[model samples]
Target: MPYRKYSELAELVEMMSMAVTSGRFMNKLDDGTYYNLQDSYETFPVKKFENAKKSYAQGIEEDEELLFLFDITLFGSATDGMIITNKKIYFKDFLEDPECIDYVEIDKIIDRKISDEECEMTLCHKGKATKIKIPRFQFFDHHFIQFIAGYAEILQQNNHLLAQGKAVLKDGVDNITDIIFDAFWNGKKVEKIR
Candidate 1:
């Protein structure tokens, strides 16, 4: 995976850190492009990851158009073994454990925090708080880091809106109960904790 390349991941993370600290906000335009609204004065178009997993069900590849749409909707947010679509977040067992790949709806995420060293995500389901953390050194994946940073923005925005009593889309939540479930568990049949 590209993220396993530590130098590449480190470089990318460093760039992102700079981008964040530069006091410029990356605004996504309606035409699937992004531009810096503050100081950097940069503009770029969205790029799709050809190596993205085509599907959660083995042997089924994701369509290029669909993947492109996913990238545009999520602003090129993706990583090996993990994908954040408009409706849900899908993930595979990268640890080679005996668990099944699964997904969580986008509406389920509640809050999250992304720091330089780690990402702490908090999910609320059935009146319970589920937390998931990804440490930087242990899993040097670009997609994971990107997701943490990008989704952190959405999570914070949604959280702020909620505090103001506004309705917002589901953005970031730590709903993955077990990173490793039964291998036979398919992407379907995921249920909220009712």
Candidate 2:
């Protein structure tokens, strides 16, 4: 839901950077990487809805928590290309189940091959088009954390740069009263106790 609202990928990056610097719910690891507290809370075994139906048919209670975990992982991978490889997750069970299958769809697109044109043109003239290959980006658990922490550290180191800019909106002119609020009022309800 949060990812859906972002207009561009760069905006999401900026928000993530802000979140890391704001210290809302991120933790710094020993290796100078930052770990999102939300990730740990949301982690669970991946399962498919059809597999859950089969489990129900087999007299096993449907595990909604497991399904939620699977969705989280899938969404995380799609948004960041980061695969969280933790042994505790029951990914094998999801794969082995006949009713459920992990989603893996790769789309191939054809682009103009400038290399052939370049070779032909270069044989006649000195000008030639260069072929460039772009590398794919991957974000693993360690790297993701490191990325967050690196940004956070950079923000801390460059506090003066941020302070130099004038604030468009001013803070409250007068003191504000404290207000009590339910912690989980605006948060997702935890389904399982374990």
Candidate 3:
């Protein structure tokens, strides 16, 4: 799916009922794609992972697009995962209450590379900083850090478009590539698909 819309968070969580055969958990992005897996993977019976979706989706805004979500704990407790929208980052720390940090309020983000598999990000805002350890997909492959650096601008653009009642379309993440003479190569510039 290039982009997914769920009226309720439960709808989104239900689709993620599939058991990962190769990866630990599902990670998704807004560019109309998901990393580490695809749509065809087999699913567990709906009853298997149903109720926990409620706890997970509690903090999500009704109209905000869920740009990314990742499971971060062994138990699907109150503090089990993190979500990133264009406006803010929502996450939970172990045994802590669900929290939200708006991008517009952030002053800085210090990303510490823990390893190739994961990282620790300290979100500094309102004279306080909260550190959250997250997966490494956002570093090289997903451009998450790049997005954070520009989210203030992104939020401004979104608000401007909203004020004008205009729609917005975002680009997805993929290796920039080209086919020249029937051979594949990384392209220097990103060109429109059409």
Best candidate according to TM-score: 3
Over 90-152, each residue of candidate 2 has an lDDT whose tens digit, in order, gives 221223331211111101112322221111100111232222111111222222233323323
Tens digits of per-residue lDDT, candidate 1, 1-194, equal 01111233234444544433333334333322222222234433223233334433232335211211112223344222333332234343233321121133123544566666655565454456555444332233234445444334344444555576653333223222121111001223222221
Ordered by lDDT, highest first, the candidates read 3, 1, 2
After TM-score superposition, the amount by which residue 179's alpha carbon in candidate 3 deviates from its true location, in angstroms, is 26
Alpha-carbon runs more than 4 Å astray in model 1: 1-51, 54-81, 96-111, 125-194
TM-score, cand. 3 vs. native: 0.50
Cα displacement (angstroms), candidate 1, residue 171, comes to: 21
How does model 2 fare in lDDT? 0.24
Per-model lDDT: 0.34, 0.24, 0.43
List, in order, the clash count of every candidate structure.
Answer: 4, 0, 2
**Lowest summed-lDDT stretch of 10 residues in model 3?**
173-182
Pull out the clashing pairs in model 2: none
Best of the two (1, 3) by TM-score:
3
TM-score of each: 0.27, 0.17, 0.50
Ranking by TM-score: 3, 1, 2
